[model samples]
Target: MGPTREQFIQYAPAALAVAAAAAGPWSAIAAGAAGAGAWAISVSAPALRSLIACGITATGCGIAAHQVLASGMNPLFALGLAVPAGAAALAHHRNLAGELLPALPATTTAAAGAGQSSQAQVITAYWMEFISGPTQTEGRKLIQAGAVLAHLGLDVGDEHMSFTGIITLPQGQQVRVKPADIASVYGIPASQVEMGDPKHYAPNALPVTVHLRKAPEQPQIAAGIPTTVEELWAAHVAIPDGAMPGTALTLTRYDGPLDWEGIATRERKAIGAVNLQDLAGNLDLSSIQIALAPTDKPSQMGVRVMKEHALMHGTMLSDVVDELAMDSRGYVRLGTYIDANAALVPLAQPGSGARHLYLVGGSRSGKSGILEQILLSAHKSRIAVILASPQAGTIAGAGLAAHCGDGLDEAMGALRLAYAVMLDREARYRTPRFPFTDPLIEFILDEAHMLLLASSQYHLEAKAIVEQLTRRSLKRGIGVVLATQTPLAEDLGNSTVIRSQLLIGGGAVFLRCAKGQGSLVGTNAVEGAEGIDLSMIPPQWPGQYAKIADRDMSGLDTEAAARPEDGTFGLGYLLTPGSQAVQFRSLHLDVAPVSLAGSLPPVAVEDCEAWRHREAIMRTPMVDQRGKNLIGSLADLLTKAEQGPPSAAQQGQPAGPQQAQAHPASSAGSAGGDARELLKPRILELLRSGSSPMTAETIARKLGTSVKHVRPRLSELKGRDEVINENTLWRAA
Candidate 1:
C-alpha cells in the first residue's frame, strides 16, 4: 500500500514543528556530541584505542559545531551548549568500560621478515606472506574463539578474529577472559570453576599461546576430553590423548610472596615440555624461559626450579683445584646462580682496597661450608688466614690454620694478633724503604654473633676492636669476613655502624635464611638488584643433597627427613661488586674434609713478638703456637683428647719459654713431667697471666685439654684458693 500525498499531508503539522526545533540554537551541539560519541563507541569496542579515539572524536565534534554556526544560530548559543554535550559524552563512555567482547589481538603482532622489504604487487607467488592478515587456518581459530565466548554469555561480536600466531616475551596481546566463562565453553558448570578473585582473570587476560609439545611419559598432563576441548576452543591448543604429535600448553605466572608452604602448594596448571633442541638452528632454547604465568586466583608463591635441578651438583673443588690460584680479577670463582642464564660470584672484591665480604645465613644454610672453601682457596693464593670461630665447627678443626680459635676468649687473641699485624703493616707501608708482600691477610670470624652480641666483660673491647677493624683495617692489607645468622643490627650488639661498614661497598652473600634476614643484610648489598629476595631461598636438608658431605661432626651435616624431589642445598643470593644480586650456590671441596687439614699451613697471623704479646695479655692464650704450627690439624688433636685426659704429647707446637715448664715442682702431679701436665697448674698459669675471667671452653683451649677434663679440675681448684669461679668464668685467686 503506497502512501498518497493526502496521507503525507495529514502528519504535516507535527513534521513542521519537528523541523522548526531542529533549526534551534542547541541543535548543532546536540547533534555533534551524539555523532562524535557514536564514532568513539564503534572504534573503541572490545578495548579503547586511545590515539584513534582522540583524533576521530575531535573531528566529529568540530564539524557539528561548524554546522550550527552556519544555520543562523548564534555562536554564543552553540558555545554554551558544548559544556553539557561534553559531559554527557563522558558519562556514556564511563558506562561502557570493562565489558568483554571478541577482539583481534593478533593485529598487535607482525610477521617480521615474511616478505620483501619493499613490495611489488605483481611478484606475489607467496600471496599469504605478502598479506598483513592471518592465514585461513588462523582466521578459523579466531572465529571459533568468538563463538565459544558468545556461548559463555559474553557479548562477543562477529569481528574477524585471527589465529593466535605466537606470543613473545615481556609484552603479548591481552584478551579479557573469565575462568568461569572458560568453564562454560567446556560444558563444565560455572560453579565448578575455583577462583580466589573472580574479577582478576576477567579484567585483562593474556591471549593463550599454544606451545606445541609431546609428553614422553604416561598419564599426560591436562588429561580429559573437556579440558582438551576448552583449550582447543580457546586456540586449538595441544591434544592430550596422544592422538596428535604435539600436546598443547599455555603459560601462567604465579607472582606471589615466597614461602615454603606457598611454593609447594601454589597451582600452575600449564604444563608441557618442548624439545627445542631439535629445532637447533631455528630456535635458541636458552632464550626461552620455561616458566608459567599468573592465574585467576593468585596465591603468592615462592616457586623456583632449584629443588629438582639445582645448578651446583656432583662436581667438587678437587675437580677445579686450580681455582686455588687467584684469578686475573683477583677474585676466586665460587659457583653460579640457579638459572641456565647464570654465571658466578667472587670470593673477594678486587681493587676495592681489601673491603670485607659479609655473609649471612641460618643453620645448615651453607655459611660454614662456604667459609671453609674460602679459607682454603685464599690460603692457596698465598693469602694469610686467621680463622676464628666462637662456636666450634669443621672449619676450626680443618687442621692447617696458622692460628685457629674455637671459643670467644681464644678468638680475641686471634683478633688482637690481627690488630697488631694491621698496625705493623700500616707503619711499614709508611716507610719507603720497607718491602711490600703481595700476600694479604683474611681474618674469617665464623659464628660472629656470639662475639658481637653476647653480654660479657669483653663485649666493649670486642666491639671496639671490630669497629676499628671494619673502619680502618682496609688498605692496610687486611679484610674481615664476618658471618652471622642474624644480620640485624640490634642482635649484633646494637652495632649498626659495624654492619654498615661490612657491606658498604656491595659485598654480601645471603644464603637460604629465615624471614627478614636478607632485607636486614644491609641496603648496599641489594641496591641495584631488581628482584632479589634472600628469604625465598628454600631450606635444604642434608638428605636433600645429591652429594653427601664427608663430615657431619657439627650436627649441621646431620641428615633430615625430606621429599624425593628435593636437592637445593648451599643455595642463596650473592651481590657481586657492580653486579646485581641473584641466586648463587657456594662451591664444595669434594675431598674428605679431614684430609685437607694437612694440605698447607695457613698464612701465619702471629710472629715471635706477637705470640709473646698475646701470651702476656690473653688470659687463656691458645698456646702450642709460638711461631710453629699452633693447634695443628685439630684432626688428631681432638682424637687424642677424646681417648683420655691431657698430656705434653697433646700439644701440636712448642709453647714459649714463659708458658713452658709451669711449676715443675708441683707435688699433686705425679707423672713424667715432659715440660707440661694437664689441668691444675696450666689453669692457674692462664688466669694469673692475664686480665679477664674465662669460660670452661676458653680454659680448655688455653690448657690444651677438653672441657670435660677441665670442668672437674676447675671445681676442685675452686675449693682451694688456687682458682676462683664466678658464674662459669674462672680466674686465679
Candidate 2:
C-alpha cells in the first residue's frame, strides 16, 4: 500500500531539509538538526551500531557547520564527510532491529496482556516477533542461546493451545540451553519446558518440533501409581535442569528406553530440581525405585514404579522358598527386583547342560552372601554339594555341604571330584542326563579366583581342571558355582571362552566391579548379563542395615563398625523379569544361614569319575564334617549321627554334612595326637602373614584343614605365646 497522507506530510520536513543542505551552510546545519530529530523519533531501542552511525553523522554536520561559518570553508567540501556518513545511517536504518518492533499498543491492550499468565505473554510475544522477521543475527547468538524460539510462532491457550513451533536444531549440536533461560526470556517457567526429539532436518539446519504445553496449576503425581518420566513430564512435572551443574543424569527417557536398560542408571536426578519429599509426600527415597517399568497401559509405554523397592527393605530366602518343591529345583532365588520381580538364576536348565553360577564382586559386593544362598538352596533342594571356600562359611556354618574343603589344594580336589562325578555319570549312562529335579551334584568355590591366580604354583593345573569342567561337563549331572572379587581375564580360568561356557548354562551375577579393570565388564561375564551402570549404585545400599558394633566385649574388636569396609553389598544387578533384568538386593539371612544346609551324601573322590581316571586322586580324601566318609572309623560317628546333632565336643566340625565322619585327629590311636601337633606351624604361618586377627575357621582354610585341627593348635599356640585369641579372631603374638 502507498504511504498514508499523514506519514507523507511528516516525512516532507526531513526531505526538504536534506535538499536545502546542498544549497547553503545554514541549510546543511538545518539538515543535521532535522536528521538527528528524525532519528530520535523513528528508532526505539536501536542497536549500538546504528546509534553510533546516527551520532557520528550528526556530529560530523556540526563540525562542517563550525568550519564553514567561522573559517569560510567551501560548504561542499566541509559537508562532504557529513553527506557520506548520513548515507551510511540511512543504510543501517532500513535493516535496524528496532524498526521491526511494533508501535506501543493502547493502554487497555497493554493491561490485558500484562494480566495474562506467563504462558500467554510468551506466546503472544513469540507470534509478534516471528511475523516481523527471523530473530537470528550474524553471530548466531540467538540460536545458540535458544532465543530463536522468540521468532517461532507460539500459541498457548488451555490444553488446546500449547506452545508449538518448528525450531532449528543443527546437526551434532547438543542443547546446552537451560530451561531457566526460557522462563526469564519468554515468561515461561523452567518446569513447563518440554522438548520433542528432532526428526526431519533442512540442508542448513535440523528442524525440531517443539511443544511447550501449559504446566498444571499445581504439580500432581499419581498416588501409588506408576508413571513414566515422559508421561510425568507430559503432565507437567518439574523439568530436569541439565544445564545446572551436578544435575545431569547419564540415562534419560529421551536417550533410550528405560525398561531394557540396566537399573544402575537411576533417574532420581531426572526431576531432581523439585523437592522429592514434596513430590512423593515421603521423606525416604532410598527404597523408592524411579526406573522405567511397564505400567497398566503397556501399549502406551507406561512405567513401573515401586515405593520402598522390594529389595531395599530386602526379603529373606525363607520368604520365597517353596518347601514342597525344594526336593529338586533348578532356579535359585538370589533376591527381589526393585519392581518386586524375583531375581532367578538357573542352576541347571531343563534341556541344556547343568549351568554353573559364576558370581563376581569387588570387596563388599555380597559375593559371599550369594554363595551362601546357593548352598542353602542346594541343600533345601536335596542336591549333593561339594564346597571349597577360604572361610568356608565358618561364621555362617558350612554344615550344608556333603564334602567341605578350603584353600587351593582343597578347591582343586573338590573340582576334580565333581568333574569325576560328572564323567562317571556320563560313563555309566551314555544317555543325556537331564538337568535339575534329578540327583545333582554341585561344586561351589566361594573365592575360586584365589585358586586360579597367576602367582599360584597350582594356577595352570587348577585353570585346566576348571576349564575342562566348564566345557566338557555340559549335560552332566554336576555343575560348578564359584564367587570371587577378582574376575579379570587372568583370574578367569583360560580367559573368556572358558568363562563363556561356564556361564552358558546359568547367567552370571555382577556386583560392584573393581576399578582400573573396566575390561572385566566387557568380558563374557558382563556380556551374558545386560549392560548395567555400576556407578549408579552407591558404595553400598546406604539405606537401613543392621547397625554394627552391637557388642563391645573386653577382648572384642570395636574399631570395625559398619560393613567390613566401605564396600558395597546386598544391592546389585541380577537377570530377572524374563530377558530384561533389574537391580536387586540379595536376600538377607534373618535366621542362621547354617539351617539352610542340605542332607545330601558326600560325592567323595572314591565315588567320582576322578577316582576312575586317576585312582591316585584318592590320596586326597573327602574330609566330610558329618563323619560319613571317615578313613579310619565310623562307629562313634554312627552313634552321633543317630543323635541328630553334633555334641559340644565336636562343634568345631563343619555343619550339615550327610553320613557322619569321625575326626581322624580326634581319634584315640590313629595318629590323632600327632596330627593336632603337626597343624600348629601351618596355623601360625597363616596368622603371621595376616595383618588382622582371623577366626580359627579362616586359619583352617589357609592350612587346608578342619576347624578342629585349627582350634586345638591355636589354643596350644596361645599357650606357647605364639598366637592370641580375641573372641572369634586368632592372631600371631
Candidate 3:
C-alpha cells in the first residue's frame, strides 16, 4: 500500500541535484553530495531519519557556500535543494493511513432537540428497569438511585419530567406506575383525592425506605437494642419491673426496658386506645430503674396526660368550700388534692381545724403561688384577707381588706388591729348574750422572719404580735399563714414560741431543701420522709417538696416532732393524716401581671360582693354605745399595759441618756442623723423630679424606710406647707 524505504533513498539524491541546479551548478553538485550522504545514513539507520535530514541540509549549505565562493554564486540558493529532498522522503512515508484511522466517521450528529429526547429515553428505560421488577432488589436499587439524585437536588420524574412517579400495588402485584393512576388504581374515590404527599400514599411509597418503617415485623423488645416505646407497646410486650404500666418503655440492645428518650409524656397506648391517632410513636427511649419516674434524669414518668375537668380544673380552693358547705364565718378553703386521673379529690372535711399554716420554700418555689391561691380562695368563700409584706408593691393590686406596708410601724398597726379583733371575739365567746358572726379574717404575713427579727425598736412589738396571734387568733376565727425562706429557729429570734403553735394544730409544707429545720414544723412536717432521692430532681421543678402536712393525720403522733430530714431540693411530699405520704407535682397557676396600674383584678366573681360587704362592715367602727366603750376600753388597756418606759418623743422632751439608749429607733436616728437628713433631701428630689404626685409608699421605698415611719415625717413636711398630701399622694407645695 506504500513505497519502501529503499525507494525513498534512491530518489532523494537525484531529486536534490535537480532542485539545486536551479540555483547554480556548484550548488547542484554540492547538494547532490549532501543528498547522497543523507540517503546512506537513512538507509543504514532508519531510526535516525529526522537527524539525517537535518544534517544533510546543513552539510549542503556548507558545501554550497564553498562551491559558490569558488564560483562567485549566492549560498542562499542551496536551501531550495533541501526542500525537494524533504518532499521525496515524505512520499515514501507509509504511516498516513494509521494516523487518519482514528478520524474516520463512526456516528452521525443529531439536532439539539432530537438529541435531548434520545437521552431522556435512555434514562427512562434505565429507571423503569430498576423499579418495575417484582423483587425488592431492583426496588431497593431504584430507591438508592432516587436518594442519590435527591441529594444532588434532582428527583426522578414521570414521562413528562414534571411530577415524580409512584411505585404502587395494582391487582396485588407491585408495579411501578405513573402518579396519575395512584387514586384509581388504589380504589380511592376521585373526589377524595388529596394533594401531593398525603398520609395515604401508594403501597410502595417513599416512606418505606426508613429502616423502622420498612415493613411490619414480629414485635420483639431486646435490651440495649434502642427501640422506641411505641414499638414496645405495639408488640404488647410485658412491662419490666421497676416501671409502671401506662408508661412508655423502650428496649435497649440488652433485654431490659428503658424510658424512651425525648418522650416527655406517656400518651401512646395499645392499638385500641382513643388517643391512638395522636401518639408520638417515633421517639427512641432508654431503660428506667424505679417504678416511679425519676425527675432529674430523662424519665418518661415526668409527663402526665391532662384529662378534662368540669369546674376550675375541679381543684380550685372554692370547689372544696362548696363541696363541704363550710360556714363562711369560720372556714376558708385551702388547696385541693389531685388524683391520678387528674380529678380533684375532696379533702377529709371542709374546715380541717381552720388552723394556721406555715409555708416555707426557697426562691421561686411556688410560695407566692400558694399564697395567691389562699387569698383568692378566701375571697371566693366570702372571707376577708389581710396581706402584709415589706414591699407594698408586691400586693399593690391585690383586692383585700387591707395591705400593710413592710415597715415595722405598719406591720405593728395591722397586728394591733388583729389582736383587737381577737379580743372582741374572745369577749363574745365569753359572753352568753352576744353571738359571734364575723366572717373569718385571714392574716397572711409574707417574709415573717424579717419582720420578727429586726434589730430595731419594733422587734419587741413584732414578738408581741406573734405571741398574741398564736395564742388567741385561732379561737377568734383569725387564720394566719406565716411564710418565709429560712425557717431556722435562730431566724425566728425571741418569737420561737410560735413554733410550738405551728406544730400543734397547724399545717406545713417543707419544700426541697438541703436539710430540714426540725424545730420549725416539728416531726410531722417530714416524718417517714425517707428514701427520697435528691439526684432525681431537675432545675425546672423548683417547687418540689419532700413532705406536705395534709389537713388530717390519723396515725401520726402530734407530740413527736419530725426528725431533721434531708433530701433533694424541690421534690414535694404530701402527708395526709393517718395515710401514707403521696408524692405530687406542684400546682401551676396562670400568670398574673405583677404591676399596679389600673383596676385591681379579683380572683372569682360569683361570691366577691358578699365577701366585700362582710369585710366593709368589720372595718367600720360600731356606732352603738357598747361597741364604742369596748373599743375605748381595749385601746386603754393595751396602751396602759406597756412595760418599757416612753421614749423622749412620747414624753415631749429631749432624749435623756437612758431614754436615748432604751429606744433603738432613737439611738439609730441619733447615730445617723446626718444620714437621715440626707434621706429627706433625696425624698424632696424624687418629688420634684416626678411630674405626678408620688404615694407615701413610693417615697418610703426611695428613702429605704418603712411607709409607717415615713408617713409621720411626710405629715410633718405637710404641716410645714413644704408638701401637699393629695389623696394618698404627696407633692411639692
For candidate 2, what's the RMSD? 23.0
lDDT of 1 at 380: 70
Question: Residue-wise lDDT of candidate 3 within 1-733, one digit each (tens)?
Answer: 7645544444554454455444444554555465466556444354235434543553454455456656766656555545555554454343321221112223322122233343333333333334333223322433222311111111221111112333333322222333332333223323222233322443334321111011224677666564544554544422332123355544322222332132333454321111111222222221102112233333243322221111112232322334322343443333333233221221112333246776666664456666665565555445556666754545432554444444545655555556555554543443322222555567778767766775544455556557667765665567777777655654455455776665444555544432443222332223322333222223232222333232125565566532212222222434332222333433334233222112444322223222233333223332122111122223223333332333445545644687545544433444565545545555677777765555676666445455666676777777888888644547777
Score candidate 3 by lDDT: 0.42
The list of candidate 3 runs beyond 4 A from truth reads: 1-353, 431-435, 454-457, 494-496, 512-525, 528-537, 541-571, 574-581, 591-636, 641-645, 648-733
Residue range 1-733, candidate 1, lDDT tens digits: 8644322222322232233234444434444453354355454442234322332343344455657777888887657545443443343343332221222122323233334321111111111222212434443322122211110111112231111221111222233244344333333333333332323333222233111111233555665434332243223322233211233232232221110111212234322221211211111222111111122333321223211244536345566666555675667756555543333434444554465887888876767777877776677766777777877654733454667777777877677666656544543443222123545678888877777775654556566667767876676667888888855664466776787777673377877667766453244233433333456555643223332323344567555543223444566666655433555566654564335544566666535333444443333322332222222112222333344324446545445554435533332233433432455777888778745555676666555545666677788888887887654446688
**Local distance difference test scores for all models:** 0.48, 0.50, 0.42
What lDDT score is found at residue 462 in candidate 3?
A: 59
Q: Candidates ranked by TM-score, best first? A: 2, 1, 3
Model number with the top TM-score: 2
Off by over 4 Å in 1: 1-315, 339-353, 394-397, 431-435, 454-457, 516-518, 521-526, 529-533, 541-566, 593-599, 606-608, 617-733
Model 2, 266-376: lDDT tens per residue? 233321112221323221233124443423321222223342233455676666666312323467677766667766776666566566777767666676777777777
TM-score of 3: 0.36
lDDT of 2: 0.50
> Residue 321 of candidate 3: its Cα lDDT?
37
Per-model TM-score, in order, reads: 0.41, 0.42, 0.36
